[model samples]
Target: MLRGQAKGMATLFGQMLPAESSQGAEKAVQWAEVAGRLQSIWTEFQVEQLSKASGEKSHYTDPVKWIATFEAVMRQLPLSNPQVQQGLWDEVIAVLTAVLGQYGMGPRAFEEAKGDPHMPLRDRRFADPEWRSKPIFAVLHQLYLLLSTQVMKHAEAIEDLEPGRKAQLIFAAKTIVDALSPANFPLTNPVALAKANETGGESLIRGFEHMLDDLRKGQLTHTNPAAFKLGENIAVTPGKVVHETDLFQIIQYTPTTDKVLATPLVIFPPWINRFYILDLNAKKSFVRWAVEQGLTVFMVSWKSADASMADLLWDDYIQAQIDAIDHVRERLKVPAVHTIGYCVAGTTLAATLAVLARKGEADKVASATFFTAQVDFEGAGDLKVFVDDQQIETIGQLSPEGYVDGRYLAATFNILRGNDLIWNYVEKNYLKGEEYPAFDLLHWNGDVTNLPARWHRDYLRDLYRDNRLVVADSLSACGVPIDLHRITTPAYVQAGREDHIAPPSSVWKFTHYLSGPQTFLLAGSGHIAGVVNPPSSGKYQYWTNDESPDTLEEFVAGAKEHPGSWWPHWVEWIRALGSDEVSARGKRRPGGRGDKVIEDAPGRYVMTR
Candidate 1:
């Protein structure tokens, strides 16, 4: 019997066989169809949509656009160089023939099985000899299936997808090849045929495969899980105690008047992703540098959401962060504190500052920092497409109850880079008999968490869909306008250069609209690595300037040169803004100098949603 997902694929092959090979094609159709459906559905629903939806903007590939893209891909593909393209085509035809021939079938066998019960009713996989293996359905279905498995197994970057919806994406190649009319592609040109054949095969296997690989190695997942292993002064350094919480967390690095005076340090990390990216394994963490430099650092550790805590929203984050700032002031009694925001948290922090500025509380915000945060949604990139009214409505419908299911967020991340996260694992671990390395980062990626649906829905609509923060619209929770110009605070914006989710173009916008003493630093590496960067990593590279440039573009042009760690620079900047005072230290709880401080590294309050 054929696998449930492979029915359509079996039929397509059945149509490829000749009358004489009908029996053979019939025998294989059932099996192949199962594989086909899995791939097709995966692409249609998951890969395409999620990628299109990752940003505030959406980009689509129409049939003509796809054909052009294929031609372009063909133009640049290494396969075209010195017969590599022809070589790939030969390998492709061989693989298809062998896979189908195992059941007494050939390309013609599928044609012969058209009338049979199991085989697809089509004449062949494609009308073209080059595309004789399978139709759009079979090819995409397989691609998606492979991509799905790759992301599921290898991805450590995604924190935005759901399980059930993971099965709905499709990556269709029909439009890409269908545009090759004999006029554009001559049958005589082995190069053209080879290009088509090579591209089709490579794209099916590699695009999704590469996508999965990207996600697996990416930090979104790796950062969360690996930290649990370090018990004490772990080798990796950024783990600094910021605030000793009620749960007995050492709070890493405690703030001191001396620490706050010298540098502008505000730690902002995504609520979905952990805050420790800035404080990951000791040697690589920024928190460690702040402690050494006598600069106080305040990092926000957002708890993972669960069924019990789904009512949290953007406002909750804004308020919690403000409370944290207040707590810092009361303890250390500093007049103001520097703020840093990352990913969504970065956007939230920016909004918080804006709100403060608008409400005449700007004095409380001495400075602000944004780490890969998004403000404007107008051209925010591919993230917008997924939230088309339909998905937004769907998610909103589910949000009234509180938390957005973590599975759903996981699915989104998986879909964003389906090829890497899904197909790569399928090939490497399942088919290739390869073993994944036992990397701590990989372990961290496996750690999944959930978001409240209501909060997420509001976020998508207000921040992304509406562009309320950047556009200066009325986004008041309890009667407060978020004005950027009102913010006279010294500002610094840092971003991960290779961040696909939050690109440089979008992040640079922070310097454009906000009226403040601002500096933008393009950090080295992807999102998480960029933020968690420690000086030990061969000295991190950053694009920054403090010349007081007028615009983001100019700032990038006149940025200063620095080879050492950015942590010291950040620490110095923050410390310069404060005064040296022992009174800033956390009070002796009830006992004496030997009194117990936070009992753990990251406290329980930080872990709770």
Candidate 2:
């Protein structure tokens, strides 16, 4: 079956290239017509499917079947029609001409112009001794990039299909190009070639051994465990588990200051990973910094979900947050507590606040801060492509033992940045025979956690598919309807400028829902890096607009750029929101008012796997 599919794809491509004699303008016109015909074919297929199911439920809700149907119809598209083929042929000739011109220039021209910013071929691999000195290799690299660019252009030209389907097509085209990059193979990649020549091919032998070792372990080896140990070098924040439940443990870090704020800060880190991401190490730990700044910090460390916890629902998670918040309030003996939620936890926090508001008890949350979390899903970015009626159904089927495996969730996220998180590791560990580095952030990234199947399914259905979170009283949790607009707690919203998982634009939508004084911040870097940014690094800058513009674009346009991390700015914002300075209070011991110590700082839940 696979062989036949490969042959069919090859035949389709073969028919997509026109003869050399084809005219350019005429071919362009024909290509446009062919694109129109493909759209018509897609429309016809949809009509026929609808007609066949006139009196019955549609099978379009079954994503696996819907995808198969889409592929079948797409295969019938006249992509290889005469005019389209001619246009493709013209693109080919143009690339060929460019490649020949570069080849004729012969190595010397390239070497002299190597560092020029305007150079067409900017890839460093093309400048290596194995390729830069060889014209053929140089031309091959250029041709690959040129062809990939043209292919992507064609993919983008495809329209009239559903948004998800269109994105899938474009993604598939890009994946093909990425897979065929010259750096993946030993013969084409200069670095790999140099390694082969250096150790007499011993690197390849070692790489093969590493691959077998990973296979035996049934997982990709992302880090060398020997390089770093948990609770010693990493996750070493000094604290005690002041409270525990079946779902989560609250860790109260030992205070580093003599005077701490009266209002204790409670953090709800996303349960998708270990809570240690906020407390990775001394230098990078946000928890430590917050403590040093004279604040009592309590972190909710969630237990890793397994088969035993498969029946856990969304209400259960929300209740866990309430339980943690109540515990912090009771221990601190404060009327209200400041709250911080990261990613999915932020979403849950918003919902929890709404639930509290419905009961007229929302004043318990003095203020709220959301990091890389989205309350509105309309512009949720590329991750939305995977959240549809059919896709949700397929995911539901994959949840064995009532839980979505953490490895599967991790793999999905890796695909969002395939080059950095997936291919880079493949090249370094499998092709280059390099050992994984002892990076604290990378270690936290590799520590995956599972999600309850019911919770995962409901989240996608209610938030992404239905988009009920934005509508007042449309979403209900724990028998209480959630109206985001009803919660008037002061909010601090931060989004990463380059975040793909949760785009800055989506995060900006929080401005529309909140009724209190709100501050929006845009930080540089991706999701994790942007949120974990510390001031001492002096690496990335952040943007802020005092006006709080009505739209994301307006805020971005009027925002002032600030050097250094956003941490200090955040501290000031919290202080302004009634976290006043008080006499220093050292870290509260584990046992107080029926609150018993479960374990040490890192706790059992974080060390579960």
Top-TM-score structure, candidate number:
2
- The window of 10 residues in a row where model 1 has the poorest summed lDDT is 163-172
Which has the greatest lDDT?
2
> Scored by Cα lDDT, where does model 1 land?
0.53
Please write out the lDDT profile of model 1 over residues 1-609, one tens digit for every residue. 111212332344444455467565554554344346446645564565576524221113135654554565344334335575465456556544543443356546666653333222222222333333344333432233333333333222233545222222211222223222221222222222244233322222332333344343332232223345543333234333445432112243554233234323446567675555555555666666665555555555566766666666677777766777776666555677677777787787777887777777778877777777778766565465455566788675444457664545655665456545543443333222233555554544454556777788888888776778765546764367676555667877777767877877788777777776666787777666777666677656777775777655676689766764565566556656664534334431211254344444555544543
Candidate 1 Cα errors over 4 Å, as ranges? 1-266, 396-401, 545-565, 579-598, 605-609
C-alpha-based local distance difference test score of model 2: 0.75
- Write the residue-wise lDDT of candidate 2 on 484-559 in tens digits: 9888888999999999989998998877888877889999997888988888888899999988488889988999
In order, how many clashes per candidate? Answer: 115, 2
| TM-score of candidate 1 relative to the true fold | 0.60
Residue 572 local lDDT, model 2? 92
Model 1 per-residue lDDT at 306: 63
